[model samples]
Target: MEQSTAASRPWLLLLCLAVAATGGVLQARAQLDSKGFISVDCGLPGKASYVDGGTKLSYVSDAGFIDDTAGANQNISGQYIRPQLSRRYHDVRSFPDGTRNCYTLRSLVSGRKYLVRAAFLYGDYDGLGRLPVFDLHLGVNYWQTVNVSTPGFEVTAEAIVVVPDDFVQVCLVNTGAGTPFISALELRPLKMKFYPQVNLMQGLVLDVRLNLGPADLTDIVRYPEDPHDRVWIPWADPKEWMEISTTKQVDSEYDDFEVPTAVMQTAVTPLNASMKLEITWDPVPQPHDLSPGYFIIMHFSELQLLPSNALREFDININGVRLSEAIRLVYLGVGVIFNEKPYQDGNYNISIKATANSTLPPILNALELFSIMSMTNFGTDSRDVSAMTTIKTKYHVEKNWMGDPCAPKTMAWEKLMCSYDTGIPPRIRSVNLSSSGLNGDISPSFADLKALQHLDLSNNNLTGTILDTLSQLPLLKILDLSGNQLSGSIPSGILKRIQDGSLNLRYDNNSNLCTNANSCRPAKMKSKLPIYVGAPIVIIVVIVSVALTLFCLLRRKTPGLMKNSVKPQNETRNDGDTSLGLETRRFTYNEIERITNNLQQVLGKGGFGYVYDGFLEDGTQVAVKIRSESSNQGDKEFLAEVQILTRIHHKNLVSLIGFCKDGVHMALVYEFMSEGTLQDHIEETEMQDA
Candidate 1:
């Protein structure tokens, strides 16, 4: 084991020198692998893609990464579009629609560290000259609040995070203070070993990364200079301190942070060698009245060589607490000291004092201060997230349903209730899509929500029997499926639960639906004839029969003539009842061709036939599956499929709209499943796992 630096000064100096010497060889410039980088120019026009001249990083429009309909794109005012400003800042994506708008960055590696950055430049893009204030969230956790109070000045927020999943969502939440807008978003992958404090449950929100001394204050070091793209802002106080620098490169090979050579080459020390170096800062304000804890790292490197007898040693203290004692510096060698835990204090003061045995004052080359952000909110339960996502895709739900379904509580998806427990990921409990224009069957995804207790899918065009899977939900207490076109009896398990008073089931106004199997069956037709044949009775019967025959003849000859005739009670049967007792519509082959634009757009091909994209007269999207001549299925199989599909309804199953059986041409029309096929979903799952 290595001896503690405080116990052995000579050993500390030797270790520093040896590590620096090993890293003495200069690194050659090479092309950085930016495949993991995501640079988004929010509000960029059209499907634009370009490379940034300054950073040589590729940037693309955010249209593909976000819901384009949720926000409007606008360029910053002409005054702010100067050549000196980055092109990203010249445009902005303003969210004036929903309360929360998000950009999903996908194709990421889970458990990897990433530097997430959001940039905002309020160049009066709206022309109202009003600055905006809003909250930003990373996935389901609150990252920071963005306050754009100054014009022409760019505001940036950065955090070093360890992503828990393959994708991360950056959301802008409207706080009603003003409209939310974003200029640019960027993500850069970093080595896992960097920022040791960041983990699955804790992130480091950057307060500042400072380069202690530099000839030009305006010069910042990042990207090409620092492989991890850490921004180092030059900081100095010439009034009380002076700069010490060397042209020779400083070695930082053994350091996990990998500080840039340029940043470590220069440092600041007190102007008077006898005076101690001190840096103090007040606490930064945070959102939601949070009292944040902080972690800090300080770097040191000696620029000048001293005589063997002349030593340079110092003791480091933060907030009057000694963090390290008797730290020795080596010439042109790098050393880093950081706190293992966070300091929960309102103010901070770091003092570097010369030890009694030291011959020179202390020097600080660079420093990094970060507020520890607790990512304790583990987002929604993964199973529930998957189930809810499947439900959304199946129904094409148009709510503000982006990102995690239940997290950060305030931004949980609309119409969803979640249960949040301490130390446990949130679980979805209730979903209400009542009167939401849902046209298909009840989604089986709802059953996947084991914690679910309440579900409302009333007043829809849903047309299948209740699924038995719904009854398997252990916690389900209430279900509403009223005012639908559903047929067939309710599931027996659900009925039992309702009978036992453990569940409240509502299935009113479903014309063909029934509570019992017998009620669902068609009633038998019976006829009777009078046995008696008296003279008066026969004359009356003959006169009545003659009147009935004339009425039937008139109705058949001119249907429009009997405008006020009483109609039959079972009027719903008039909706194209087939010989097989199914109520599904029968379309002519010509009608199918017209709906599919003469089979123009092919969606996919299956064993049965090719699927074509089409739209009904009312603009409803549909997928027409035309049977090929070489298909193994015969007319009997097609008829059987049509009969079965017309009897079953499920939220996860594609809805059959109509069928065509004109001559040799045969096709089945179904509601378009915009989310794609089961094979696509399986492939996506496999890729994510990989």
Candidate 2:
């Protein structure tokens, strides 16, 4: 039956968005530094910036995203989740159906261009072992379908857009396939000239971003090193390709068409600079309504410290058309060019051959392709911004509330009313903080909003005064303050207004709140029949009896744990739990090495294996235990330890994060136990005895 179910499962159809990864193509020197850069380690919260030994560059946690909702902040746990990553990528925010999940970005310069990058890695973070497919959006526009086709691998989509107002909204919509989620996201400021032709059409949809000519295949280049923080994936010299590099410096004048110095430093030139690269790819099938043309870009810089007389000139050939001739790349200078062209029929790849050269062989530092689209700018309302800002602080809301409150009307912040207009920014008109677990006095500042007409602070723990200063609002009509701890007699002016039918009041369920004599009386209870009363008692007796019986059965089977005993020192586990939860991730042996930096950062040596302190991609601290090859502990002991750790959870107990069991190589991963061990604490308590 299980095999049948597995066989019936639908194989995921990859909805890979064909976006070409192209940085500022129009090239300018205007850049946003770390302070201006917005990095959102979505679904996770941590503040860390470090120089990654692998990338040889500094990467910081995404800085500006608010978790204003009550959604779960989850970390994905799966066999395929990659290792040696900052912990941030492991975090995700899941969205339920019927409501769209959105994140707003603020602290941005208006009318400035930005590179929006959204990353997703669904390593079954919920531990369901099932990958989900969903859609990712930019403002109210559809961006791409987020399909976790291969486990542990990352899928990313990017777009370049101008900041319409003071903010922008990145949202996730549930297409009814599964709960949508996001792992990490970032925004880089670009000059208006980044995509000069972008104004001629819609925004550019990213397809591929590739870095060429690296000795290492696993090499990845990212931030601090590349001030723009463009992620450059390295492509090493393949067997079919010949690689050459000169110890000469290379530079480019077009700062907006910037190519990373790291990539430009190395060049991929054919054995014969005259021979063209016959690159051919299949046509990317497009929907009937979408255009299939792509904008191709190649980056070049003068390589090889040479005399001024040496010149590298080549013509670019795409398909059968010769796009450029007499193109020269001067030493220590840069040149970047791109053109929009449709893919050749029956071929998905475009061939770029270097022919008709002037001096040197053809070489490329980097290349990218993007689908062009019209530019769009949409943001939130300026009015009523302060009221919500004050409300967020007063309630200790999550930082996920970064974008506009209602501009893109379809993706408004939860429980808020707005006056949305197509070309005009929306204005805050109402707020509903119902059943939100809010605790405090409803701020009088909220009463000052001139546009606010309806305010619902329902089912909260508000205290102090009733009908305090809220009556001053001129447009106020609807108010719901029920199910709270509000006290004091209703103000005479408010009561008269409520009685005169000038306002719609919902002030029920507040125990101490008094409006009239009948309203002051305690809530009446419904009486139960004798059979109902007796049934509950009988049910309770049966539940307690069954619980006690199970307790005895467990105690009998796990006698060693019930009564403490001095067991063998070599033993890894004691009898405790019959089963376990093991909510953390399980890693493979290969992943363990990456997470532990090949197990080089050792904290201490144990009887079973060495303990190494490690951090996730987002810089979260953890400890990994790699079983020793010669250890006497066997499979049974390892399983017992894992089971015991999973069964027990407490503040004082060390958490078993995950484990690895590959053939004979077994290991355990755990949360780092700080403040030393319990034994150390006891020993310090009896310092004189030592």
Candidate 3:
């Protein structure tokens, strides 16, 4: 046995204890008692020694070899590493005279916290004769568990967690020059049982899979705990620690693994209340391992933790939209195999939220999700499509021409055009409809299409004065009106109003307009009444002027004009028994076509129809809508959209732009919202994608 040095080893032991504390809380009783220490001797030629518990002495052969002249700095006997006795050592080992020689070492230290005794020897080699030249190196032979903190040992243990101390060797390259090599090189700190209370339970699984057979255990990864020496189960295994079956791949899409089996057991168990559980799996088929890669899967089940609220739904703010939905739990699966070690090494994490139904109460029980093994080449298309479709179906709002609004691709609708350059969600652009035989007033609900840009409503049998509601549009630019029987003069001054603020407006056509001096302005003038007297005429004129000024001011400030101006669209369906027998109101296609001027009345087009700004014989301004046969829309989707639109009475939702049922020329009429769709504002970088 080598003599032990009694200095500088205790300081190193204390440093390693501080590192362990960062991992987590350690058992207070797991530390070593005082009077334990590790030391090396300078008097020995090639022996290294350690003392634990202050009495027991452990030593290793060829542990403290030193060489210095092997390199340009000095001689072969110049290198030596040994613990200091009161921080001093005089040990000497020498080489033959004038011969450059190299020295190597293999030593053992406490697995817990061993200190390294390092030194260099170079002066007066060869028994105080000629100087020798040799190379020196340091290497670890292999791994072996050692206990230095055992009770009744020789060394004096300190208050630190472990005794003796971990040790590492520093090498000086080309010490003597002649091609020196040290075999069995290893440089890792010894580990002891670090986490005693953390036990591997049933929920931690290894999903081994076979091609067409049952679960295979041969490929599963395993971790073993030693009973004698205090072992430290690593926080996680290295990337390439496990292997999976060659035949079957694993995945978590189905929320389960093909086969789950426990490969290792832990001595520590989770807490009874508020337990925070974690599971990690090491991967097989590492780059150093053989081909035909394998994978590891770990599943964790949180036993009985309760949420803060018993209510099913959680209100969350997503991309500026306030969404209230149930807090759902989703299964997570992590895969690692061979080159896929980083994933298994715990570098990246995955998060998934489960689905919650508003109508049902949440289940108060353990949450279980499986970790499965899947081939690296597996695709995500199937999962993504199904998931998105499920969300759309649950929402239940059908998109006109677009099928489900969340579809991967946009479908062509009547007057709708989609942006070709954008990704995923394409933008809606231009909508045009010059004329097609149609009837009905505009539905204000059309404004919900925030992506709309250009809207045209030229000609149709729509009746009613153009409502000021349209002035609220922020993006409207163009407006067209050429034909239609509208009679009231356009209120040009009132055209610029908005629901909450001012917006642009477009107006034309409707030849009966008398508000402005145009060719179509009425020539009729009220017959001059011979005022009873000049005095009375002057008085009447003054009173009229004052009243007109006051009215104009009041109109400008009317707070709820948009909300109050909206009228409910009246339509009736034919049902069997009418308590008071009444005739059904219907019209033929030809009659409607004549009203639209041989399908000449044309306005703007959108996802639904070609709008025609028109008027009834009574001179009511209205918008006639005609649905396009070319639209990819179906009846079910159309009706669903219509149902929602008609029921929504908000000032922001466009009203039923109106409709017609002339044979295949079916259309709806609406109160013309002079302001176009929101699409206009989105153009030229006016808005951002929220």
CA lDDT, every model vs. true structure: 0.77, 0.61, 0.31
Q: Sort the candidates on TM-score, descending order.
A: 1, 2, 3
The candidate, 2 or 3, that scores higher on lDDT is: 2
Better of 1 and 3 by lDDT: 1
If ranked by lDDT, best first, what sequence of candidates would result?
Answer: 1, 2, 3
Q: Model 2 Cα displacement at 177 (Å)?
A: 2.3
Candidate 1 CA-lDDT value: 0.77
Best by lDDT: 1
List TM-score per model, in order: 0.69, 0.55, 0.21
Give the per-residue lDDT digits (tens) of candidate 3, residues 355-408.
Answer: 353322222111111222121111112232233334223333223321222212
Candidate 3: misplaced stretches above 4 Å?
1-400, 404-414, 417-429, 436-438, 449-453, 484-494, 497-690
Name the TM-score of candidate 3.
Answer: 0.21
Tally clashing residue pairs in candidate 2. Answer: 52
Candidate 1: count the clashes: 0
Query: Model 2, range 517-620, lDDT digits (tens) per residue?
Result: 22343322211110111122345456546645765676679765423322232333323222332354566666576565556446566788777655444334
Error of 3 at 130 (Å): 96
